[model samples]
Target: MRNPLAAGAATGVLVFFVCFYTKLLNPTSLPAEPANQVARSINAEDTGNNRMHANANAHISWQCLSESDLRDSINSTENVIVVMPAKAAGTSLKTFAKSCNPNTTENLQTLLSKNDAFNLLTKSWDMPGVYASHFWVPTALSQLLRSISRHTLVVYIHREETSRFTSAALHVLTQWCAHGPPKAQKNFFDKVENNNHKCHVREKKLVEILKDRPQEMQMGTIELLTCETYSSIEEYAPNMLFVDYKRANVLQNLLAERYCPKMTNHSHHIGKGAEKVFVQLQNGGTEVSLSEWLEKKSSYLEWTLGLNDKASCLVQTRTMEDNLSTCDGSFIHAQAVLNY
Candidate 1:
């Protein structure tokens, strides 16, 4: 029972602590305040530099493409349209447009088209203005390149999926539960004969009914946009200008690179999405600190970042600090990438 190895390990630990204390007790050997500050500063600088290197060197993620060089063309164009996924960075694209040409608000209609709202694109009741919104696939607008004028620039925005999909599932669950469960009723179908002939089919399983719900009701229309067969934009639409979807300010950066470099900071950012219940369960009973969460989920997170970097998305101005991966916002520069 008395293992020398265990005893030796304990003794080594105690001796190491004693030596550490000895060094701490001797003030003369400790670093001076100025030297310590310098060292700390150096360490901070090194950390920042290292992160920059990692971000740049990352094989999956795309680097921030400059926007300052493209301001003129973006403002001059009259029929430019931005087609973004629901949670894509469409907001930033509009903001960038405004910044590019503040006076063009009146004349901007000729230049840009958004698909979302009246107030966002047009000032008056009716005007040929920019349209921006979450237009699900298979819509008439989805065939923009073929239907519309060839001169019209259509920017298709996208984000990394793994995290977005999980968040979307949670969003659906929360929305469904918010309506409260359907009334529980006993089956009277026993009395009815050949009920299947009629349009009204009685149901006992509420949960099963929900499970059978249409894909769009449970998951956003964007799910349909995901192609299992094709990999790149070249396969889908060759004419579309593909931007990296992960830049903090997807639209802003895109515009900045195309229009206004002066304000191109790529400033918007968002936080990671909700952790899956299964993951939490797997780490059950463990302390499961934030650090551990980040460590375990780095690879998944990086996938989004990589997608963000590679796929071109219109970055929006409204910064979503809570969930960055969902939007075209910048992410907090966590110094190192997570291994998992």
Candidate 2:
């Protein structure tokens, strides 16, 4: 069908051009170069401002809680939550936390909202909590009494790309070794097992096993961290600390000291533990450890950050990570609260 709006727009543009040639625009209508430049500048400013507003609006996927309501929750509890990307020591940290998350395996993978989430975390009026990863947390370290999220401390642990992916791969193998394989992977795994023997197969074989939903491999860990920290830092930086996890343990240690002082951290030592997987990939003529599954990490980041094939965007991401540092004192500016 013909588009009347497009036809009308074309006709109007042609008429305007004819008028410019015949009637000649008035100086008021068509200003001088300086005035035109000023007009363009003003229009550009308006367009940019509108774009930012649209971006902010697009980001808020959930109905947000009011600042006052969030603050009331924060004020009621000095809750702590230890969050980390999947396989990034979150399981270990969770063992130490007095969790408020629903007691189910699903809660380990669910992201909750302010209305549904913080109520549980702050439920123990006398006892605060550290709801380990996968629970939606709005807080990052900002000045107390400012933003709802700022009041609560979010301890985000950072790990290298390969280590995180390797750990994920290990978790899958561990589970598969114990339980044959989850239902999702049962088909491929059954066929593969008919041919091969154990989880000591190449990552190509394994990623293929969990091919239906490869994200379950990364486990939403990177996505959760990127969304929370990036959005928070975008809003709270300069006035906030964007400290990488290595710089933690100051606050983590303080929190640890306050709670589990005599604890022995046995799992602090790092190892791939999946030597067969790493050996298979490294020996695959690429000489890179777990290089086959590195593609999973790359593709996952592309999906998460929308940074697919853009070297500049990758550089920008790295620069942001490089900018993190510890801040003992940073004020929370609740002027704007982006979604958690």
Candidate 3:
């Protein structure tokens, strides 16, 4: 009532002290706009363009690797090397990898050494992995041995041997007869039948190679080479993943979810078109069914090797049924052919 200016000054000081104490007690109550912006920037960079980016913040539990654990390993690692055979849905794997991490390249044949492979793997700033399809293990073993790292993850995609052989053979046949005359198809068939012919000779050599060093052959064997390579790599690498081409569709989703978490929906359509071509070939034959045709081809391959049960050694009939079932009506046709 007496000194109004002095009283006002005292009130202002009290309010200031109260506000300071409140801020001190709850430091996080203030908005950190600059820090938030930086965090946002980093997240954007990590998730940009489906490119493979390093996950420094990833929580990796190596002791128990689930699908998520494998993904975390892939995301956190500097290199992921995938070895797959031809006609083993490698294209689908590549497509899935692109959707998950655009920073991947499938160029194993071109790389000479592990260092070269590593260089290619990290060519892009945020690359996740490098897929090397249609590769021979023996040829690339030296380089692969050289290129292994603590952060490296090696994956091998396995297919049924007989189905792989049939698919590869049919693929070659389809390509050879794509636009050619019927006579060209007959000639090609003749070449395949003749043991001395280039096709027959090559097939024979491939079988021998598979027997001697299954790892050297593009189409691996059931017994030695491929299995040995798999066991050896498991012992050598810190992280290794095996993808059965038979269950590729399901596994693809699991992998995509881990590597490309931001992607809402992902689908793989590799090798679908090839099914139509296979169906057309099956229907085109009037006297023999597609399975019979495949058998005849298998017989010829066995004959080249001068063995009665050589076909058994090359491919498993049960696996063939599972593989053919995926081809539209091809399995049904094969069953009819078998019955006839």
Candidate 4:
């Protein structure tokens, strides 16, 4: 009779070999990666076209870009530039990267390890045709971008402050603060045990950090609290493409358009049905939306309202002449509120 034990052993060996080869062939059949992790190139033709546009001074094609092309451009050239607000929801650095390439978990981990905005700048200054995102985009980055690129396109994103703050706080608690150095201990929380109080403290600290003159201004916890501040980026970078950060598919479409506009038209959220909403606490309203709460505290609104009494000769100044003309001799009440 056949040896039952020998037969069983032979079958087990064959199964193990098959399983090992399957794993070697298909790596992505493994577990999921972290949020915003790049996977692989979704489109190749678009990627090649974007690389050509990015490499030279040609017009951008509206097509889906591939991860390999993006990676090659980044690895090879250092001429192009991209700016993104940190902690933005619609399009983040990870989202942008994913549009071109599917980065692995290991790759993302390596990037996070070198998350310093300044360091990345210094290291990549010599490269060409690479558009990178610096979280804060410090003075060094601004100077570098201004120096190299022939045609620079600035994309600015606007979102309701409260939503961004909430997302940012959670990101800090979960990502940076959780694994950050001992110095970041005060920012992290173990759980939502007292999230209300924790949120308040975090907000206060953020506001304090963002406090200062315009030149010294920087995004902190509270800066993202104002819808106006995000939109007001135009005042700083006039040529910037201000996009509503709340729109879905914005980041992907933007990248696709930048690389290959014809094949993949990136429709801006500008005229899209409803605009982004921010609810303010009605001076004495009991229940106020988070967006409204942020508006009340944002420096952008504070500065605008504060300038009303000063009567500066600014270009877009709403002078008494404009207001009086609109009144047209009607019973101009001393106080008629115009909410727009």
Candidate 5:
């Protein structure tokens, strides 16, 4: 009774669509490329020990790269990707990258597909160098490490988790107050109290905003991100270095000696005048020892940062007597402990 040819064609169309949608039609296997191919391709041109190109683009800013630029950079075998996140000595690293023959990008999703990523690393044999922001995106980080030459030196800059959080929170507050009404700005410190219902509501809003990002890009504690990044680098890249944010100056000098020997030293830009403001906010209305203030907010701080209770003891023990120097001192001490 039914038309056999029409029924058969309909079934075929449905099967094809299913295969296409499920990626069953796409090739699942790719020829394994030697990691040395990437290194050889990138190092084909010996730019001398000082890799800084005289005519290297110097229009450095905290801007993401264009899609076209990103494609070109990742595909080009010449660039070394630098993954530094916000409030993690990014400005200093940016300066370092710009000083070298490095292409910088902030777009985290530039290379999303595995095939394209593989081709980008294996195909291109020409490029000066690249320095890009990976932030804390796990998938992108994995793909990036896999695509780069095994010999490519991957760099990561990290800060102490608690100090980083405090700085980041203060930065957010500063930005919010800058654009907010004068009255609201004046009351900003008061609003930070957990007992304030409005503050609690704002915290919820912040969490929701963070939750809206891609799972890999979700806001995480600095410790968690650092651990993940370290693990990934260990698995993928053999040649890599982790820079401490506190000793960024030392790392900057070392990086210059290795990559841009001729480059001049540039001081870190952020957190210059922030220490005073940070002290004020943390102390609230009254003067208190760094240990006392931190101890008072121990529970809230631990919960907010997803830290273990023992972390409070470490924080308290490490707290400096002088409030003025405590913020900076704590950062240095934290890095020393980690690096030790």
Candidate 6:
């Protein structure tokens, strides 16, 4: 009753002092969630209808890094391991790791680079200080790199499943034809072999790894490699990073430099062959649009071969030098046309 305004002002001052004292007494704790929405591919859960989007406000610690930043991380960390999944940008990462620090990187890479399982069994390969001899050897459903040191960084570069499968399929087809241009009657899928060190993530293997293995599986030289999918990567390593394969297409650039250093980036762009195709098609002059005409005619010059972007190198088996044959889709289609 004695000046309500004075009493209210006093109450406000008390509240302010209380809050300030609390802040000083105990520093603010980190938010409940860790790194948020960094991995748009994995941190995101699929809702439906074939769309990719991150979970809104989802708590996570995994960082999505660019090539430059990841290279720096690789250089700085005392012990680093890259999960080199096949048909992913692994070759390029390997190139960068070697370039960054040949000593530590080479020390680790050489132990298992031969990729000879029997040799691993028979030989007494000296273990690197860090237990990472088998880290990069990724098979489908493979466990990726992990680190206990908060200082250590673990990296996984992911390519989307379908696109990767297409690449693998193409590789197999190339291998089949490279053996000998097969008769059109032969079963293309007959007795296909598993990849040597090649893998694309498969849904089947992912389920097995999640259900079968320990959340924090450790590695040994004899360990058969498992390429880890994103869902439970945090369990394997506290500090995990997801490098989207498409975002970090450094392999192509590395290959370009190593193989054809003189060729500028734009030199790879489409040339007049494409323009000639368009012109010839236009000259056909169907009343219908040329695109629609091609659809009706069931023929169009296919350059990309389901390849969306320029690949670092068009993958081929080493044996191709000895036994090269045509695996061209158009050629195959020409053979199969009568089958339809």
Write down the TM-score of every candidate. 0.37, 0.51, 0.48, 0.33, 0.46, 0.33
How far out, in Å, is residue 231 in model 3? 7.0
Q: Write candidate 1's Cα lDDT for 234-277 as tens digits.
A: 22332333343555254555456544567766566556543321
Better of 3 and 4 by lDDT: 3
Winner by TM-score: 2
RMSD of each: 21.0, 12.3, 25.6, 26.4, 18.4, 20.2
Clashes counted in candidate 3 amount to 3
Task: Name the regions of candidate 1 deviating beyond 4 angstroms.
Answer: 1-76, 90-129, 174-239, 248-250, 253-340
Instruction: Give the TM-score (vs. native) of candidate 5.
Output: 0.46
TM-score of 2: 0.51
The number of clashing residue pairs in each candidate reads: 40, 3, 3, 25, 2, 4
In model 5, the runs with Cα more than 4 Å from the true position are 1-79, 102-109, 112-126, 130-134, 181-237, 269-271, 274-300, 304-340
Ranking 2 against 4 by lDDT, winner: 2
What TM-score would candidate 6 get against the native?
0.33
Per-residue lDDT tens digits of candidate 4, residues 62-135? Answer: 12223443333333432334444444543343444434433311222124335543444445333222243433
In candidate 6, what are the lDDT values of residues 1-340, reduced to their tens digit? 5999999999999999988888788776424444555455544544221223222332223222344554454456555455534555555555554444333344234443554323433344432222222243332222223323546555444543334433333343344434522464244222332433222222232222222322112121112211122222323433544444553344234333433344314122212111101112234432332223233433211231222122211121111211212222100000001111
Q: Specify the poorest-scoring 10-residue window by lDDT in model 3.
A: 331-340
lDDT of 5 by residue, 183-280 (tens): 52344333433232122113333333222322222332332233223333444433443445665665455455555667646556553332212223
By how many angstroms RMSD does model 3 differ from the true structure?
25.6
Regarding lDDT, does 3 or 5 come out ahead? 3
Question: Tens digits of per-residue lDDT for model 2 on 1-340?
Answer: 9999999999999998987876464645564579789888877754311212222422312122333433343334466555565655565556555332224222422424322544444445444444555333322221111243554554445555445555565565655655666566554332233243343444455455444334335433333333333444445532222224443333344444444555423234355453223324424434334445555565564444332221212332344344332222211122334544
Would you list the clashing residue pairs of candidate 2? Answer: 143-331, 143-332, 249-253
